[model samples]
Target: MKHPLSQFNYCPLCGSAHFEAHNEKSNRCTECGFIYYFNPSSATVAFILNERHELLVCRRAKEPAKGTLDLPGGFIDMGETAEEGVAREVLEETGLIVEEAVYQFTLPNIYVYSGFPVHTLDMFFLCKVANTDSFKAMDDVAESFFLPLNEICLEAFGLDSVREGVKRFLKR
Candidate 1:
């Protein structure tokens, strides 16, 4: 497949057709001297382990991997820290409130939304959910459930980063 920025033929700032690849990750407009950088976006994922040691996972409701197992998280919004963003995603996907969490790890991932592959920096967090009672699937999740850490099927996770992160999460 071609690079994701290949579609960006015109300069976004000046709407000039003189834009061309300036570097591996940026485009520069010769006419307007504008450079557009295709930087990786920030995303977050939560690893909420219940008292029984079952990790809370969700079935994706949207495309790119519908019905696949995923952690409760999403892209970090503007003005939110990774911790804040992760808690918001967990709340949106699983209806759980994260009281505390620690940044565990990070993984680079490709998130294909609307058929466009966007590079992302996925931040994984070890979260403490208040309780599992409010765990109702919503938002981007079609269903919410817990899987025993040992019995988790890594293949069920659709995202490569999630699969890798879960491996590290399970090991430690």
Candidate 2:
């Protein structure tokens, strides 16, 4: 049986391209019996706070929720730590350098866009800006601004991941 969602060219354990459907939920390599589970990718995100205590937010220019406000964060690359991913994503999206950051929370959610399921283990962090004056939008970011926490509205940004992350930070 073939899983409707399973698509693989090789066995994850043996790196062999020859594989056969073991069942509706798994595949077995012809060379080695290795099963690959359909799972979500892990992502790391951050809620950056400047010296003035203003939360830094960006208007997303890309999908998965375009034209919406979000925190300066993104996917964690392979072999990269959560902290590293948070810093890199913040810089890539907002060009803001983070001075210090601490792990906040984790959310396991499915991001569905255009009929594609994006399973993500989202790791959230609280980051402090090293140089607030140098912050600027780089790529996949239409605009960036620091807003008072109280002014943040859920209606303006439909992404509950961001809203929830910030709200959690504020409460702590």
Candidate 3:
């Protein structure tokens, strides 16, 4: 697993080639005395449940976990709150509008993107939707559907944090 900071060879501020690893999570430019710290990006995961207690899930359409079962969510964009990000992701991927998103917990994860490790803090939420009637798989989701809580198979989820989060949710 490659560290996210290892991908950068030059300083972003000074554009100097003297940028070197300063610590486990940062780099320093010897020429400009500028230091950049690599922090975990904020992400969200939705645990949407219908009246029957069936959990909404999606099949990933992209790599890093393509073709695997996943929750409807993604990285939080700039200028967006975690709740806003999760709701937006749900609508984008599953066509479901989240009316309520109650924060449940958080988990640390390393999402590999392109080829670099992207450290993320995944916020989990117990979300509510008006109905599943408008559901359609879109964006990064290849397919979307609901599964009975008892029938959810942890192994089907390819992402480590998602599988662990599902396990935690199941225990609740």
Candidate 4:
């Protein structure tokens, strides 16, 4: 799938096409002398489970993983802490209020769609839902439901980094 912002020929900084790859991390523009690099953005994910040990998963309503099951998460906004972002993303995507969470794991991965890099430093946390009755699909989510951990197919989700984090958490 093509990223929505992948059709640009000019540098975002100075609107020049005279750009050169500086390394695996960045690009340098010869025209306006601007450097563009693949900087890893921080993202937070939540593993919210019920008393039955079923994990809450949401069907993505947006790109990057549309139609696939994903743990509630999104980019950490500027000035927001990791914990704050995790809780906000969960509420925004699944309408589930999360409480009592602990950091589980951190994964570094790169997502490339249509040759554009989406480098992410993903932070995962295990949280308990405060009010399941409030759960409802919201922005960027088509639907939300719970599934047993063992029933979740990691390969089908297409989120290897998140799957690994869940696996590690379950193992411990």
User: Model 1 clash pairs?
Assistant: none
List model 4 lDDT by residue over 1-172, tens digit each. 4332344457888888876665655677889888776568899989888878888888877777678877888789999999999999988888777787799889986665565677789998888878765688899888888888788777656576777776776687
What's the lDDT for residue 18 in model 3?
97
TM-score winner, 3 or 4: 3
Cα lDDT of candidate 2 equals: 0.78
For each candidate in the order shown, give its overall lDDT on alpha carbons.
0.90, 0.78, 0.94, 0.78
All models, RMSD in angstroms? 1.0, 3.6, 1.0, 3.6
Per-model TM-score on C-alpha atoms? 0.96, 0.80, 0.96, 0.78
How many angstroms is residue 38 displaced in model 4 relative to the true structure, after the best TM-score fit? 2.3
TM-score of 1: 0.96
Q: Candidate 3 lDDT, tens digit per residue, 1-172?
A: 6678888999999899999999987999999999999899999999998878899899999999999999999999999999999999999998888999999999999998987788999999999888877799999999999899999999999999999999999999
Model 3 misplaced regions, further than 4 Å? none
TM-score, candidate number 2: 0.80
For candidate 3, the lDDT comes to: 0.94
**Runs in model 1 with CA error above 4 Å?**
none
